[model samples]
Target: MTGEEGLRACDLTLAGLLHLLLRSSHHSSSKLTIFAAQQAPPAPGSRRQRHPRDAKLSTATPSYIYIPTTITKPSATLPSTDDTDTHYRELDLPSFFNQIPSITMDHRPQAWGRPRDDVYGAYNASYMNPNGPNQATQAPIVTGTSVIAIKFKEGVVIAADNLASYGSLARFTDVKRLRKFADSTVVGFGGDVSDMQFLDRHLQSLDIEESYDLSTDQAPRLNAANLHKYLSKLMYKRRSDFDPLWNHLLVAGLDDAGKPFLAAADLLGTTFTSPSLATGFGSALAQPIMRRYVPDDEAAANLTKEKAIEVIKECMKVLFYRDARSLDSYSIAVVTKDGVDLKENEKLEKQSWKFAERIRGYGTQVV
Candidate 1:
């Protein structure tokens, strides 16, 4: 062979061997180089410091990303709900800290000193940027759709597809955002993932004590009416500050007045008390049916919790049957003064047979 031709053949042989080595090592060749944009390391000596202050710092694990960290224990200091509005106004969370003097403790991971925000920004993900990670174009992580819920005789029920798509990708199979607060309230979230997480963290900071009024012997609860108003107000406040919780929400629970409550809140902070409400596709497809039950000022008052829940479930079933982006499995929550009940991992009916029995234009029907 000519000298040039011999060298080219050797180079190809080496490249083939390297490709085989990369495959066996379980590391794709493309992943070998770290992107230059995300190369920050933690500040030196920051890891050895102890905490004299009690600001909470939580770590974000991929699976259980948002675990609660209660700053103040509610064992002895908690108040019962019987106290008048004046009492709640007097119970300042910051004041509780002043009474405790100081809690010179750091509950961070042994290797982590400051908030793990910086630590997670590295190593955990390969191509993340401060602006966002490499997957910025990958669509939202926890997108919310409008959920319409109505109450039933025994309890309330709400449903969302067991789908958390990465944009239109249908990437995550099990992301149930509906949470039951103290077994009494079912909070259905609709919107961007980061905002949802922010709200979750904010709620966790409420000390778990403020959720209920104690004299009532109620579990920490937020009826639809209360939750709706709180979210609307918060969303409005955040928007005013130029940071919005890109979410629409439906809070279903019994209000402080001991009556069923359902309300809608949006990123703009606009809120409306409704017998039924929906966020995304539900607004277009399910809203009409929900409105049938809760249409106008007169019908909503007559609607019962049992009926509302049934209606919501029917809407979910329809969405599953109709909405191409939805799935059969979903989560459901019921809220009342007694507490919240959340159910995840719901399944839709089987449709696998339809594809197998297709009459025409079928897969691999090479005739």
Candidate 2:
């Protein structure tokens, strides 16, 4: 054939093949029929000639009908009412709905966590879980705000307000942040109350061990400097393990040489020592006030006990007035050669908001 005639013949063959494939795919019948390439129609009485590969290709084509995949048949039982009055129980709607069985009905032996209510026993909610591992809380829910401390000629004095805020809500009002480590040492904590409690227990254990160990007198007990070092190491260790204790701690007491020692340590294990130290909002609000009285180590040495107490009280007063997280009630501790004198229930005297009445542009007050 010439080039144009050959091209026309190829086009006709392709069109016929595509038409056959489309019809087989969309038609109602599931069976697919594939035709061998057709030549001009054979002579009327002549037997049709077939390619040698036609029989093999026909055998290779699938004989089974193709059925598209579908979702499984639903087997839901429907409610039926009998027309004939044969023996059949009537449906009790109220009983069917109200008398539903409990999921833990067959669990006997008190279930460890829950008690059998029918036997005069109440469900115990005190236990969290009976059969599984529990998780430790890594988040601080209720937290305290700040702790402030300063050194004087006699020794160191530390103070912290008695307020534990639940997020922004002022929830607890009487939490004492000042903890007496021993007769001489005092530790003030500012951060998560739960974490503070854990550290308090730990310090209590340490104190007990020190008290029992008879060699404490000959060897040296943990002074303020030693305690600060130990705590800094602990904080850094926890931070390295990626589970840091969420707190800022102030260690205050007399050193081995009978000199006052005060230091601060934070969650990241950072430690700083000076005549004065504060944590949380106290670092911002109260530190400046305390620094005014004892600006440096020389000033702290000259500062008397009464003056130090007065300065700390003034700091606490300023915190209550300025810091939103602070409260009037607070705990104060003075560490001296004599011993640690801690008073937890001290309240700020003359703490009042009545001064706002005279402020202009507030309520009905004229500007």
Candidate 3:
């Protein structure tokens, strides 16, 4: 029909026109059926074929229902809702992901986003304590004991034990407490092993920096005395800030003037220089022995290298029998005008406890 005839046909109302516009815009496969109050019913025994959308209405009455021709089937990649295996497989992905350990802090309790149970629960790692304080290690755990050094005719001799005690128990037996810095200076540490490692790395960085600067013609490099002064200032700064590095350090080498240099700096930043120095328990036990050999600068100037080494070995032997924190294996360094002679894994002569067998009233010993 033409446009004007269709617009005027059957006296169409506003609602009817709106309904026609909506139905016409729908999919082409959908048929529109209209039921009016004035329309007559079909004759008896004459079955009228109904559209699929209108089949649900009662035969004695007239009605209409719109059914879209396009079916919303699930995508080919998506599993059917009725398949239990598909659902199980999809759920297994998360379990697999959770089972995979993460290097980051993502598997924490709050980040897990799942209920706690024995199978998949909170991560319990020794290094991770969720509710604990966020503070660095301020106290020493494993530590080494005394570092003794003395100045003699040729250069300075330094010694320290290889023992690293866990609290009061001698746990690690092979920890070298002596560090050689820049091939000319030997630093003997006598406290917290962690802080010693930190300082060792710092000295390594300094060595690297100095090596890089060797391309230029420098007048003089850092000597043992200069290193001692630098360490004294560093310790003092840390002490003033109430965060001192828990270590007593002995810096021993030849000075810029090629004289035997021996100096000490403690955690309190106290600096002391003499012919002899001893840190930790050695200050009380080994100091006298060292002084007897090199009592003054003049005596140290006259002391021979052989006599100086004999004195240090005697002191170490006494410390091994007397000092509870001392070990038989020690690291000894002799810094001279030639270079540093470091013997890191030096073991003392075989010792015996046979004398203790004669002691009375100890470990069921007969009187």
Best model per lDDT: 3
Better of 1 and 3 by TM-score: 3
What's the lDDT for candidate 3? Answer: 0.73
lDDT per residue for candidate 1 within 47-91, as digits (tens), equals: 221222222323312211111111122324433332211110111
What TM-score, computed on C-alpha atoms, does each candidate reach? 0.53, 0.62, 0.61
- Residue 11's lDDT within candidate 3 is 36
Model 3: how far is 41 from its true place, Å? Answer: 74
Separately for all candidates shown, the number of backbone clashes (residues 3 or more apart, or on different chains) is 30, 0, 0
Candidate 2 local lDDT, 1-367, one digit each (tens): 2222222333444434433544554533323332222223223453322222222222221111111111122313322232211111112223222233454432432353354476645666655667764334378888999899999998998999999999988999989888887688899999989888988999999988888875645866877888889999998998898888889999999887989999999999999998999999888988888888889999999999999999899889989988888888999999899998899989888667777687788788676
lDDT of each: 0.57, 0.72, 0.73
Instruction: Supply the TM-score for candidate 1.
Output: 0.53
Cα misplacement distance, residue 149 of candidate 2 (Å): 0.5
lDDT value for candidate 2?
A: 0.72
lDDT of 1: 0.57
User: Which segments of candidate 1 are over 4 A away from where they belong?
Assistant: 1-142, 152-156, 211-224, 296-307, 349-367
Arranged by lDDT with the best first, the candidates are: 3, 2, 1
Misplaced by over 4 Å in model 3 are: 1-137, 350-367
Count backbone clashes in candidate 2.
0
